[model samples]
Structures are given as C-alpha cells and as structure tokens.
Target: MSKKKEALLAQYAGHITEKFSETPNMAFLDKVVTGLGPAIYNRDAALVSGSDESELETVKANFLIKKLGLEDGPHLMHAIKEVIREYGASERNKYRAVVYYILARRFNKEGIYK
Candidate 1:
C-alpha cells in the first residue's frame, strides 16, 4: 500500500491484462492482482498476523478458494499445483503465482496462458 507499490501493482495488473487478454474477466484479474500484490510483498503480514508458514499457506489457500469461487476438491488441489508448476518458474512468490493462475483460469475458462 505505499504509492510506489500501488503503482507497481497497477503496472503489473495492466501487464497481465494485456499479456493474458485471452482471459475474459480483466477487471477481476486486476482486482485480484492488485489486492494480492501487497499481500505477496508483505507476505509475513499478508499471510497472517502470526509468523507460521503453514498458517500462512492455509490462510492464502482459503482466501483463494473464496475469492475464486472454488470448492475444496481434488480438482481444485490439482489445479493449485498446476498453477505453481506453470507460473513458478518466473515468479518468485509462489503464492502470487498460484493466485494469479487460479483467478486467470476462473476468468478465462478456455485458458489464459494461451
């Protein structure tokens, strides 16, 4: 939430919008990335008030599930792993990559990466 970070996330959101145009819900994607960018940057506080990594992942996963309208199932878990695999190469923040891919998939059912 600093102005600099906001600017970065805004720029990033725009990049994603253009780069992943195949994805339909640009607005939602923008929101997700914008909201998550801060969380990812300040991951310690973003994940949770506490300092446990497991708790952090749990909180992040739950947030993604609710935000993306996904349910708890094998498919969801599979998709989460796939998101990590596909986007993890370039993205140092696995949580950000996971959230990005998941929301991208939701918005662009056909495939956003294409």
Candidate 2:
C-alpha cells in the first residue's frame, strides 16, 4: 500500500474504534488494522526474506478472512476505501468515523453482512 493509503487506514482504524466504542465487540477494528499498513509492511519483510505470491496471499487472506471473520469482506473492504476518503481531512477523523459507522450500521441492519 502507498504511504498515503497506510496513513488513511490508520485514521480509519481510529475512526472505527471511536464510533464503535459503544459496541461490545471490537473484532472488526482489530482485523482490518491487521490487514493493512503493518500488514503490508510485514509482507514486505516476508518478501525480502523470500516469500512467494501464493505464500503472501495465503498470509494476507488468512489475516483478512479467518482472523477478521467478517461475514462480508467486500463490503468491509469498500468501507475501508470510503474511510480512505477521509485521509484528506485528517483533523476530521471524527466526521469520517460518523460516516463509516453509519455505513457499517446500515450494512449490518440490511443484512449485507450476511
């Protein structure tokens, strides 16, 4: 991921944590942050140490799917992209959090998560 994207995901993680603070479960927040930034950074390390495409995919997918265990990954992925839009408004992560949280809440309520 680009540095720009890495920064975006960080803010997204903070936004997610803030918005979902009332929720009992924090699994998704943890899962996504694991899927990005350090995740890419870690992959770079693995590749430098000689990991292949299949090996890399296996590692990334396992973290994104199995660890996150979200029922709908594509939606979550999209929401992350949407959260990326907030990178421009770094000081306004709270705004982005509100927006994405609503997106997530709706996705859940509409059964999109299933």
Candidate 3:
C-alpha cells in the first residue's frame, strides 16, 4: 500500500477505535479486510484501490447480511441502512458507503459483534 493508503486506513482505524473503544492493530485490520469472505467483502481490495459506490453498497449488504451473519437481523445492520439512505439523499453516497464499509471490516476484524 502507498503511504497515502496507509494514512487513510490509519485514520479510518482510529475512527473505529473511537466508536468501539477497542484497539485493533492496523496491520491485523488490513489482513482481515483483505481476507474477508466474498459477497460483502468487496472492500478487502476497495479499501486501498478505489471507492466505487455500487461496490460499496454491495459490500455493505454483504457484510451485514453475510459475513457478520446479520442477515435480516436488527440493530446494527438496520442502522447502517439508515445512514446509507441519508448519504444518498445528501449526495455523499460514495464517501459514506466507504466509511460504513470500513467500519464493517473493522467490526469483523476485531470480532466485535457477539
């Protein structure tokens, strides 16, 4: 990864730490994101590559409905959809999608959900 990619992921990792109050190493986070199961795991590469809106949306649903096993489950995944809707309305869909994408990856990496 380039220095810039490293910096972005680092900043994103910090955001996750603040939200969850758990410290996960940057390197570990990267590994897990890259190794994520397919479906919602478009982010494994998207994180450093490019932030595609369509891919991010699928990534979001995949993480929630697939990887995290939140499929149709309530709480977190539902809440994330709400944000996705807002981002769409505000025309920030791409950025917010990636943000949520990063959070989902972080959650999986830290094994956050019960």
Candidate 4:
C-alpha cells in the first residue's frame, strides 16, 4: 500500500476501534479501502451521510444490491439503518469504508473482496 493509503487505513482503523470498540480485520479493511479506489481521497466522497435518504438509497442500491448481489427488499434498508445507528446518529464523519466494511461483514460478503 502507498504511504497515503496506509495513513488513511490507520486513521480508519482507529475510528473503527475507538468509535465502535471493534478490532477490525486488517486484510478485509484493506480490501474495502482499496475497492473504494480514488473516492477515498476525496473528502466529501469518503464520508457517508447518514441523514441523506438518497445517499443511503445509493448505498443500498449500488453497494449492497449491485456490488454484493443482495436481493432487493425491506431488509436491506433495515440493515443500512441498523449500521447507521451502530455508527451513531450524531456522528458526523461516518467514513464510507467503515460503513461498507460493516455492511459487507453483516451480509457475509467478504469473499467479494477476496
């Protein structure tokens, strides 16, 4: 990994550990970050807006359904809401990689990264 990527990964790992009190699987997290591509370097793109319904819909449609091949249903939205809740409603900087990591694991889609 590049130095910048490493730094960002470390920063994200810290957020996961400190905020969620979970020790992340480094390999999985690395793949999640790498999969995110250049979007991670963009400040606005890197963050998930829990308050935006459209943004959440995009995550469900694009990431969950399209990327992970999950079927469309109410449960998907419920899962997204659950993740946002877990991330904390009041939390402003909900990193996209962390959110994706949690969702990927929630649905047992880690193999997609492998």
Which number leads on TM-score?
Answer: 4
Q: Report the poorest 10 consecutive residues by lDDT, candidate 1.
A: 44-53
**Candidate 1 residue lDDT tens string, 37-102:** 546566653323223446545644665455554556666555545544544355443445334545
CA-lDDT, candidates in order: 0.48, 0.40, 0.48, 0.93
Q: What is the Å distance of residue 91 in model 2 from its true position?
A: 8.4
Clashing pairs for model 1 are none
What TM-score fits each model? 0.50, 0.29, 0.41, 0.95
Tell me model 1's lDDT, rounded to 2 decimals.
0.48
How many collisions between residues are there in candidate 3? 0
- Residues 23-113, candidate 4, lDDT per residue (tens digit)? 9999999999999999999999999999899999999999999999999999999999988898896789999999999899889999999
lDDT of 3: 0.48
Q: Which residue pairs show backbone clashes in model 3?
A: none
**Which candidate leads the pack in lDDT?**
4
Clashing pairs in 2: none
Candidate 1 vs candidate 2, TM-score winner: 1
CA displacement after TM-score superposition, residue 55 of candidate 3 (Å) = 11
* Model 2 agreement with the true structure over 1-114: per-residue lDDT tens digits: 467555655655565555444442334433333433343334343121111345334433553345434564555555544433433334332332233334445345323222
TM-score of 3: 0.41
RMSD versus native structure for model 3: 7.0
